[model samples]
Target chain A: MIDFENVKLKIGDTEITIGAVLESNGSTSNLKTGAWRSMRPVTDLEKCISCGICWSLCPEGCIIKRKDGKFEADLDYCKGCGICANECPVKAITMVMEEK
Target chain B: MAIAGLPEEEYLSCGHRACAGCGAATAIRLITKAAGKNSILVESTGCIEVISTPYPETAWKLPWIHGAFENPSSIASGISAALKAKGIEDEINVVAFGGDGSTYDIGLGHISGAFERGDNFTYICYDNEAYMNTGIQRSGATPYGASTTTSPAGRESIGKVEWKKDIIHILAAHKSPYLASASIGYPTDAFKKIRKAIETKGPTFVNLFATCPTGWRSDPAKSIELAKLAVETGVVPLYEIINGKHVVGMPRDISKLKPVEEYLKVQGRYRHLFRPEKKEMEINFIQERVKENLALLLEYAETGH
Candidate 1:
């Protein structure tokens, strides 16, 4: 029998399980997909309404409601698809080019 | 307060490899929310499967399993049977999901068998209209006149000549208790249908019209708008078939459908139809077909068939 606890292997700072089985759920959050963004979304809190359109429509589910009741995307995981800006009713979000 | 009445709990976490603004990802988020915590998801080999699970990492918060490209429904059936054996079949939800490549073509037989047996599960097909994961090859779900790598519209040929397969009608033929067609554009409606499908006993099916901006060559931000246009143009009607009775959902009036051109012009797949000279004949054909399909659905709804 294979010992579950002793078979850990490390790959580039991240530990990989032996059989491609992840013991923890939703571990993909560790991957920062924001690196794929060529554009970044900027939300205008002054004009923003907490309609949750951005939160509901976000493909990554990266948008979170801040303490002020306005929702903004977590840039660490946001890929900058611009759907939030496009679907924003009040035009509260705008897509800007990512800086090098 | 509840984020448009949807549960605040998220089952599909952030940071996956799906393209930015993927409609399937949006649909999946809503789906997992509806399925809640006590659920098992069976995934067919497709884009979501590849993107969500990248060896020792998974985006799914629920118990999930991936079978081959053509056997998600079969796996779901087995899972349902196991649940039944365990005597907790009614306590958990079993949801099988796949892309158009698997649902419309490769795994059609397996799905048919599962539906025939009245397995207690829900099968959701996120229809992006092509084999997007494998480089945009045409599938049975690919609508007519849409160009793909395999069905290119060139000097001599117009895109895919065949009409999209009426998958809902086929599934309804099995006398399944519930069958519905939804679109990511209408998240609330889609969520309701998903919850209802999961709550229903026996086999239920939901055809979710998801958009593929990468495959369709459409602007990424316009995915939801394109899906909305598809429904408005009568190209993808949102409706439910309950016990063989048609319950038409949106765009009930025949006069309300926007011209098919409005829907086609935004996507690069149909660019050939307009550029290098407009193909009026092809455009008219698509328009007529859309009307006829919606009219048929209206008749079914009226006749209680």
Candidate 2:
């Protein structure tokens, strides 16, 4: 058996393995890249319509839909490419400095 | 419930070695999302392969194999044959992917052979318009007037004097069950074409117009926008040729197409064209070429010739 503990992952209750999981879903899901962000996107819940423009166009695949259907940045893998902010059809996403 | 627009699975990982805004990676991601896990991939030497698979660590989750630049199609055919011999050909998709160098140039003979043999595989060319992995040399697929390293634009010349090779017509000439051209900007269309190409039992071909920010000398942020511009301006018309008949996908009305300048402006490779005096003649030539190309496709659609 392989020592998966040596590998980084946030399994979230799925039986996934090295060969089967292949190269996506944040690659190393447990590693949060939030520190890589110099700026972050702030979504106005009221001003935003859940058109999902940000969810699909994100290069990092970091923008995810919450249970309520509104989208938010995972920040874990979002290199803060700002592609979501640029692609947001309604201008609902704005980029701000990562103060924290 | 599925996330409305976001793809559910990630065949391409966030940590892959592609450039920050690599459009070819976007196309690769989208294509893998469509192909699903039951697929085995055959990749030729190209940017996608070099960057994704670095030694022991690989970026692919599928049963993928790397082949020489000129033999991905041959390898795919062998895989398909082995699967058929085992009576499991129907359950798996053998997809061969490469850059324009491999698809339109180096691997053309093998591609033709595979298609002629009616191999059960899909060949996808991630066309960034030049041999980008080999330092942006001009490939057969590079459009006219683009300044690649081998085809530099200077006082003696404007740029590549030859027009873009008509690979689509060549594939269509084989009476391929399915053949289409798509861009990374239009994921919906790209996804559909990828799915269709894989699902079709016989040979299929898809040329995905991938934008290369490094090779094209364009802003990484503008990659998708440039891809969108290519289709919107009819410079890279998105369409499917099925059973020897052509069908237009986007910009159905040719009149709505924007000028070539709109598509050329963002790319650094075409920057010199807009200098002080401007390469008015070349720009006009490109515009006319786009028109004639579309007109010929339209005519072919009507006449079936």
Candidate 3:
């Protein structure tokens, strides 16, 4: 089973961790730069309005909301192009542009 | 052979580290072609100044001077005055170059002063519409609903909450002999405007909408294409106010014009405006503003004032 808590995504060559739960299933590779790193979307829950704008606007459609109504960005399919942060209406998301 | 009907001599070098697909760089290239060899360039503090000249080396091929962030117009005015006093007005043409940050926000005072004095110079604002040198900070020219470092995505704020200042109209207020707006998207038109401004006797102003790849989060190859879309979408109209007369250029078929979505989608700055939870009211507000502004400009042009 995948741990939605420790779930992380790869955007470009950077690794992004989403929540507290960490999970490992398979290896991921960076297609653009050929560098290896995990990427995840970090959210300031205090600022999030549960608007789900990030989920709808995610090009990869990797973001999912929990049963408790809190939205979570799935890092496994997240591309880390920063469109989520750009799309977040309530300024709940920020794309941490990290260098590998 | 002349690249753009000018000599092979270059005023801007290629080694300067501008953001990939920078409109300001392209503006420099075009302005150099129009100004030719006998010109003085005044650069304001912004992306061009910070990236091109890192304390020592500069990429300028002509006589270029760096001024404070808000002083390109004032400094160029001073140069023109001194040149006139020295009886060297016949020897050199004064040209001032700055980004929108310096031109619209910090440099408005200097621009007003020069225009009021009717200084013998041509001022060009390579408008990228933000404080790009400081990590994509918002300025006066940043359109409504566009995100920036200072105007981050957040609740109750749709990015920059203001419309772009009407620079040509403001210059018109100064009663400048020649004033116009151009875009790198329209090279021939831009070239013509630059040449016309330089040839004018008194102070002239040209505000060109240059694209920024890094700040806008767009593809480097699509810089010019995006600039063109800005014009077509009526986001940035191409027109001139010559001797207080408004002359609109290239009347686009608004019927064939693509939705503002197409133009906004390509850049990361407007990414927030394209969401579902994002109220259509916000997007509609922006759309209405754009239409209103364009209509006002068109009306002014139609009225011949």
DockQ of each: 0.80, 0.18, 0.01
Across A23-60, the per-residue lDDT of candidate 1 in tens digits comes to 77898999999999999999999999899988988899
Ranking by TM-score: 1, 2, 3
Candidate 3: tens digits of C-alpha lDDT, residues B92-201: 98999899999998989988998898889999999998898888999888888889999987766678887788887888888888999999877668878999999998
Worst 10-residue lDDT window for candidate 1 chain B reads B1-10
lDDT of 1 at B272: 95
Clashes of 3: 13
**Candidate 3 chain B lDDT trough over 10 residues, lowest sum:** B1-10
lDDT of 1 at B302: 97
What's candidate 1's i-RMS value?
0.7
Q: Which runs in model 3 stand beyond 4 Å of their true positions?
A: A1-100, B3-8, B276-278
lDDT tens readout by residue for model 2, B1-305: 23444357766655556665577877887778878889988899999988776554566767778889999999999999999999999999899999999998999999999999999999999999998887999999999989999999888876788988989888887778999999988887898899999999899999999888889998766678888899999999898988767888876767878999988877889877996568898899999989888887777777865
Name the weakest run of 10 consecutive residues (lDDT summed) in model 2 chain B.
Answer: B1-10
Ranking by lDDT, best first? 1, 2, 3
By DockQ thresholds, what CAPRI class is model 1?
medium
How far residue A58's Cα lies from its native spot in candidate 1, in Å, is 0.7
Q: lDDT score, residue B38, model 3?
A: 91
- Each candidate: what lDDT? 0.93, 0.81, 0.74
Candidate 2 stretches with Cα past 4 Å from truth are: A1-42, A95-100, B1-7
